[model samples]
Target: MRLETRDLAWSDTWRAARLLAHAYRDGTIWAAAGTVAGWRKQASLTLLYLAELLICRWEKGFALGAVRGDRLDGVMISYEHGERPTPWWGWLLRSFSCLFAGPVAVARCVRISNDLERLKPTEPHVWYAVLGRRDDSPGVGYALLRAGQARADALGLPGYLETSAGEEQVRINELLGWTLRDEYVLRTGAVVRTMWRDCPVKVAS
Candidate 1:
């Protein structure tokens, strides 16, 4: 299906969140937290994703959407250099809120958050933070990735992303020219791989 890309609108937030929640429902750290939390899983994750979308918007980051004739089939959220970090109060609030997801889940969240912080690149770069697509959507995920990477290239910034060490994910990153920079295992025992892609350089003819 022909997919068109555009900046995600305010009206797309909730729907985007729902799609993300489902997309990550079985594999991500947040999904692991939800699994431990049991009944509060859905609420906790939905809220977390909602918060992320808000932060992405506030940071003036790239929140791109892949739409098929008005239906948002895929979404990607990324932050360029110079964007403000998530406020202390926002982190506090999110932490406190995760308490309802139970102690184990909370601890997992803290550990994963810390690990991500420690792994973040110090140089100016673009962070490819979140990407999601509906189950029925095909090629939309790749479209989102290409769009985000093009923006990063335009800004003359390298791109960074972390994903599960699954074979498919690793293959996809390789296909997109992202190099495997590092690999680590989370406290939850999930293996994660950090990938980097250098910005395309223009040589004067």
Candidate 2:
């Protein structure tokens, strides 16, 4: 089987959002009602946020595969750069949101953000990937990971990510040579595990 990958465009935003919403709904559901509620509350925009995370932060690559010149089989969104860390406006936002969104929501974001800060930062040329497929498209996840891996190799750096504590994704990360680096228990009690793979080593092989 053959697949093609492309850089993500603004036009792909909506579709990417749908996939992200699906991915995070269960993954992030355990968070307090406020944070999770906003995400659950605005499913469409939440999807949009996922796409924005890729496009706005990471030097990105996106792909959509087609089969037999017809059906859209899968989609992958990825990034390969360190984020220019911004001011902690998210904290401020949550503070205000608590006023209207209530205590649980505010507490949720606070817990989640604090949890994420535990990971060690990476250097330039790193890449990260998230993939989703039409139920019929097999091997899409691996294909996406490989594509991101290839990008990191070309750039000569490692890639990092935090995986939800799910068996399938964990197995995939292991197969792709990613090692667990850290784990954070968010306010919602779901464990998010950080992992990394050395791109240069993989690329040199």
Candidate 3:
């Protein structure tokens, strides 16, 4: 199937989030809330809310998708540092939406997010909040990575991401010149690897 990377619109929030939920169903970070009953359902709802906030409300955020016809094969939600601020209501919206995901899920997700944030580099760089592709969308991950790296390259900034998608992903990032910064084992014994790519590499689109 032919695939093209393009900015996803707010209307695609549910679709995109559902795709992510399926791909990252067993991911390290989101699975922190697994102790909760119906954890997968809670996680899906949480992703819906988070996707809404990022795709529609967050000023610094943007989402890219690998698409074919009407379906999304892959997605990368990202944002730049020190660029634009998230509106105050954005957090309120998330807090309110978390009600559906339950307090326990919200709390664990918050903790994981905070820990990952603290572990990341404090430099100005593009943050890939999440990246995933369907099994059928072969090589979609690399295409999205190239597009993301190109954006950082154009901005004269670096690229940053945390992944628990296992060794294959680590190798993919390394192949693209992204350096593994560090790996932190979460409370659940899940290992999250933080990676960084130096800015301004020439990319042939």
Candidate 4:
């Protein structure tokens, strides 16, 4: 059955977080923050996903979910450039939730977010922040990505994202029309690739 994709309701936060945690648990890029924060496997990812979802929601970032019957099959979290300005207090409130992981976690998260933002292209574009799906859902991730691409196309801007999801994911993004822009290797030996896809539906000049 084809899963439906739409904006996930905040009411479904727990379920959505759990699905994201499970989907990216084995991914090295996904586990980096937790490693620095001292969170173990499942617990770390679950908390990370929860923190991200909450922060993204509070900051007006986009959350697209793929659903099958009663559960979410995948999620694509993104942020469009200059969508809505996030207030200072709003950031504090959203970030406070991550304290459950400890102060180190929070500090590292801040550093990482700042580092990635610095690396992003200055051109106006959509940031494909987080993309993951259930292990059994073969195409849910790509489907949600295509949806993101469509949004970028409508905006007449490119889409940009960084991935530490490994080389396999790099290849997949290439197939989806994302070109490798740069790469950074972390101290923990993880490689994060910065990628960009030109407007997917450009009109002929």
2 or 4, greater by lDDT: 4
TM-score of each: 0.88, 0.68, 0.83, 0.81
Question: What is the lDDT for 194 in model 2?
Answer: 79
**Model 1 / residue 31 / CA error / Å:** 5.7
Candidate 4, TM-score vs. the true structure?
0.81
The residue-level lDDT of candidate 2 at 99 comes to 59
Task: List, residue by residue over 1-205, the lDDT tens digit for candidate 1.
Answer: 5789999989999988777767776666765554654446666666677778888877788789899888889888899972447966557646645865788878877887677768878888889888889889877878999999889888888888988838787898889989888777765667788888888753221
Clashes of each: 0, 2, 0, 0
Give the Cα lDDT of each candidate: 0.79, 0.57, 0.74, 0.75
Q: Write the number of the candidate with greater lDDT, choosing between 2 and 3.
A: 3
Ranking by lDDT: 1, 4, 3, 2
lDDT of 3 by residue, 1-205 (tens): 5789988877777778778767765567656775444664646555554645464445656678889888889888777862435466666656655766677877888888778768877778888877878877888988998998887787877888888878998998998988898898877887889998887453432
TM-score of 3: 0.83
Better of 3 and 4 by lDDT: 4
Candidate 4's residue-wise lDDT over 11-126, tens digit each?
Answer: 87777878887777666544455553324445656766776777678887788988888778999888887343556654564554455545665566677767776788887888
Candidate 3 regions with alpha-carbon error over 4 angstroms: 37-57, 82-85, 201-205
> Which candidate wins on TM-score?
1
lDDT, model 3, position 29: 62
Native-referenced Cα lDDT, model 1: 0.79
